[model samples]
Target: MTSETQERRPLFKPVRGVTLAGLIGALAFACGVALTATSGWLIVRASERPVVLTLLTAIVAVRAFGIGRPVFRYVERLVSHNAALADLTDRRTAAYRQLVPLTPARLGTKRRADLLSGVVRDLDDEVDIQVRVVVPLITTVGAALVAVVTTFVVHPPAGFVVLGSVVAAALVGWIDLALERRGQAASLAARGQVDRVAHLVASGANELGAIRATDEPMTWLAYAQKNVEKAAFAQSRGRAVGVALALAVTGVATLAMAWVLDGEVEAGTINGPFAALLLLTPLALGDVVGLIPDALGSLARSSAARDRLEALLTQEPAVRDSGSEAAPNETVPHLRVRDLTASWTGEKTDLGPVTLDVAPGEHIAVTGPNGCGKSTLLAVLARHLDPTGGTYAWGERDVRDLPLDAVRDGIAFVDDDPHLFAGSLRANLLLARPDADDTDVLRALERAGLGPWLAELGEGLDTHLGEYLVSAGRSGAESVATATERSISGGERARLGIARALLSERPVILLDEPVAHLDGPTADAVVRDLLTASAGRTVVMVSHHPIAFDALDRVIDLPAVTS
Candidate 1:
């Protein structure tokens, strides 16, 4: 989509509940103004020694207005909150769906946790604008109009004073919004830095301490916090100016109304009791206008957030599905790539114009230096990324011509950092093959060299794996912080990942440095067991350690990029 189209899109589409809430809010504020003005009129008339029966109407009206204000406000709060929450749910779901296709390629180089945090925070800021800015602004304007018109019908000069005061308050709100917009971008950038630093510190504390790099990350955290404080102080100054302007205008308008009423009373244009009502009208209305500055600040923040969300959602996916929907052969499929080149960004090539071929049921190992394109090749083969040049074929048919889902269904790709979800071992393994029973799961685990580890587990397949550890003796384990301490060893984790792939039962399996963190002996043993378990399936393994495989059919070595 074009930038112009995104700019024209509305952030908050009006909901029915918000509309109802807005009407209720306006009525509530109007009641507050009426309560204050009627009470003033009633008190002035009472002091003049009027009969109690003659004052009954004003007395009853004052009581009704006083009681109605809180009631309407309570209903307004419930309606607006429900509407905002419903809007938040829909928006979050849409944003997540848009992000799925982008995945690792377009999300940038930031840590996954930091990217997710920013998305969540931005979504909250966008949704909050409805309650904070839109509904309240509607209510304030509606109440102000009622105040101006009512006072005008009673006394023209008092009406003009109230109108001028409201205009001045609006001017202050606009100026505050402008000032907030200037600082909001900087504040958002600082907030992103803080999130990145905080996520790194929280998730990698052990690694940093082990490498004696803890002080460096701490220094970065301090720097980000300083920027956040500075930005907040600047934004706060704008809000303060808005509050002072509102107060000053309100005071001026109140005194001006009193002066006009004094002249009108002497000229017999308005009675003494009626003059009291005009004098207090502006004071009551000023309270509603006082909320304008903060509402505008929220408007500025949410506007920024909306723009960010639009930009992210409009990004084109790295790989597009082909027009053709042909399916590959269901049986074990052969794989071939001739002069294949891939790029994370289309502007430059990151992976080579390299070539390889594998017959069905063959085992091949790919090894290269750090900057080589082993993992990039695997991404292209798995259809998670697009190839910039040449061709990749499955079962002698160009993979691009096949249905995207059909091509991906034939292969299982496991990387070094496989995520273990917060669930039981059975749940984790079942994700690979949902139809697989406990017997199938145990067989896959045993084949992947996890039989010994499974035997040691007190609950076997029922052992809870992540966040909260559960065993036979421990029935109340809820400490997520220590879950990692109870996790399996490096080799066991690698084998579990392999077991997941084995259980997939796909025609082709691609392994990307799955044992990179294990010791030399463990790495060799894991690779040996992985090959044994993946027998008769077409397998491709990428490793930096390059363990010798007795049953390996072929080896492909990638050359490093020179320039």
Candidate 2:
């Protein structure tokens, strides 16, 4: 939750040298093509066989240069490709960091799966535009133009034809812009639908199976299938248009080039050899021109992706800190919330201008019915969300002005649903403190009551506990069920959550229903451990458990907020 080091561009560094290399490679390629063409013309027109060797030597030199240019091309690609990949990596990191601060406000607005798709798939696809479509197109087309001009010095008609074809291709692209936009829109819609269904299927696979057991699996599956079909239809339509336009242009160019060559040859202005070379130029140039519309459509899709990324980059983190404020370790913060109000801005307000204060070393309980906003209160207190009204101050300073990292480092939160990452238990525990060694890991595991789970795995601390079992002896479902049924029940997960929070050594801890999933004995033990763990720190917890009421220093209840 800490703010990453503030740096100039997070992921995308512009490498000017790559652009230079691409240009050089493209130029060399075009030169090689023109040289080979000129050498053929020389062999055909030479008055003596003695001159044929010179033309043959020119052909060999051109082929050698052509072979070597791919190496330069590879280097150019490597630079741009790595730069793009690195930029995407940084953009993703920044987006995640931004979400950490905005998550409280997002509560029900943003879907994690959708945002994840945008970060991983969409961002990657968009980078393909810059690295693949844009850079390559520019370099090749620019080089083609140079080659055409050089050819014009030899034959004005051929040069004119090349220039005219390029212009026609540009015009074709401009005229088809509207259709391209429509295609892009379709592609975007298809992606969004896919993301929605993917999230639904992933989160509900087990539940859907349960429904299937009731002889109603077809109902949901039928609906999901219909959605998939619709998305596929849209995507297919988009791509079909791109392919259709590309083929249409190629057809038109082929016919037009043949007609042009026929007239030039019949008029005796250019011989069969010259006409042969002229025809070959279009065969190559036709492909180059045909790619224009597809590239534009690609550009459209990539632009949308860029906008998504830029939206994240350009966003102001809900809590912004320049690191000039006091660090977490340097300050003992006594948080006070006076008439603090928060609402889910779009919907009717949920929780309100409730008042509360917690001095250093104080433990407070927030108890309320399901919709009463106990969780919302804790979120606002942790600086996850800004209050609609009133003020939150830490040791007489406005909490908003405090550095975001400072707020995050000072407070540790354990939500109702704890996340277990796909890694070893040791790795999951160390997420809060990556540098934690074996002793610290063992102590944390012991506190969380995960010792038994570790012992069962036999690999102890090194065994993987991801959703999928790493070894044949252990299956994912079996491991989860085993851990839940015996070693770490909901109560145990709660205890583990508390243990993780405790390991953070944060000054303020916010836990939502920490003992809700626990059995009576475990719950009681955890409540005692919670108090002991937060002995000298501020602890604010939300729980409807009556047992929590008797053990706390103070309790506050928030009534549902109204407009």
TM-scores, all candidates, are: 0.88, 0.80
Clashes of 1: 0
lDDT of each: 0.84, 0.66
By TM-score, how accurate is candidate 1? 0.88
* Tens-digit lDDT string for candidate 2 (412-470): 89976576656766777777777878887777666655566556654466565543334
* Tens digit of per-residue lDDT, candidate 1, span 1-563: 22223334376565659878888899999999999999999999999998899999999999899999999999999999999899889878878877876776788877666578778988899888888887888889889999999988877888999999889888888888988897787788888799888988988998888999899889999999999999888888888888888888888889988888897799998898899998999899888988898888889989998888777777877767686767876488888899899988777777888889889999999988876888888889888898888899888788888887788788888888677777889999989999999999999999999898888776778788864445654333743433333646777777878899988888799998888888888888888888888878998888777675556898888987533
Clashes of each: 0, 3
Model 2 TM-score, all chains together? 0.80
Model 2 residue 344 CA deviation (Å) reads 4.3
Best by lDDT: 1
